[model samples]
Target: MDLFTYYRSTSSYRVRIALALKGLDYQAIPVNLLRDGGEQLKPEYRAINPQGRVPSLRTEAGRVITQSPAIIEYLEERYPEVALLSSDLIVRASQRAVAALIGCDIHPLHNVAVLNRLRGMGHDETEVIAWIAHWISEGFNAVEQLIGDDGWCFGASPSVADVYLLPQLYAARRFNVELSACPRILRVEQLALAHLAFQQAHPDAQSDKPA
Candidate 1:
């Protein structure tokens, strides 16, 4: 397997966490998001993923999978020994919901593409930064209300929800979103850092991390 990834991509980070938790080893194919007018957008990469996204995973036998959620779901289904979802149906649904809350809801609004689109529309840096902060705070409010205060999002083990949440927390800090009110979320973030999977998947640990 080969993972086409960019260091700072939150979506890519989620996949890395899932892969590590599954105890899978794959070749890291770095796609520098900041070099040569963004490598993901280049013709060579577009052929690999027309969407030009950060995470494009090619299976060992050469099946390309795009989108973080789909890739994680595939991993969960294909490699079930270390399940990322809860056994209980309701709990599993809740786990997926939290993951989507961040992945589908919050991150999309703050991703580099969206910000660049905002810039193209004549939005200034101040306005763009404010936009990112506003969206993250709004999302964190929902997360704070739902997630428990502990090391994990669901139980003793980190679920798909935690895989998703940690990356957004990274984004929150990057955008300077105040998380003081979200004590549970912050607590989980602190605990997650101590875990090997999370640490291994951190942006700083990526091969593409800036020097």
Candidate 2:
């Protein structure tokens, strides 16, 4: 398997965490999102992922998979030994709700493209930063209530919620969102940081991170 990834990309970070937790091995093909006028926009990369996004997975049989959620679902289905979701129907739905809350509601508002678009529309740095913080705080407020108070998001083991939450936390901190009110979320971050899977999949651990 080959993964086209950008080290700092939260979407790529989620996929890396999922792969590591599942104990899957794959070659990392760094796609420098900022180099040479954004490599992902280049023709070469568009051929790999027409959407020109990072975290495209090329499977062993040479099939390409795009989008982090879809790739993660594929991993969970294909490698069931270390399940990222619960077997209980209601619990699975709850876990997926948390993942979607972060993946869809929170993360995209502050995405590079969105931020760039805001800048294009004459929003200044302070305004863009405020925009990021607003959405993250709004979503995290709900997430703090939805998740459990103890280890991990749902229970003793990591779930799809954990995989999704950690990356969004990284983004939150990157944009300097105040997290004082989200103690439950911070506790989960503390536990995840100690886990080997999360450690290995961290942005700093990626080969393409800047010096």
> Please, what are the lDDT tens digits per residue for candidate 1 over residues 7-88?
8999999999999999999999999988888999999999999999979999988999999999999999999988999999
Model 2 pairs whose backbones collide:
none
Model 1 RMSD in Å is 0.9
By summed lDDT, which 10 consecutive residues of candidate 1 come out lowest? 146-155
Overall local distance difference test of candidate 1: 0.92
Give the per-residue lDDT of model 2 (tens digit) for 1-211. 9999999999999999999999999999999988998999999999999999888999999999999999999999999989999999998999999999999999989888999999999999999999999999999999999999788899999999999999999999898999999999999999999999999999999999999
| lDDT, candidate 1, at 160 | 94
Model 2, position 140, has a per-residue lDDT of 98
**TM-score against truth, every candidate:** 0.98, 0.99
- Candidate 2: residue 107 Cα off by (Å): 0.8
Indicate which candidate wins on TM-score. Answer: 2
89 Cα displacement, candidate 1 (Å): 0.6
Off by over 4 Å in 1: none
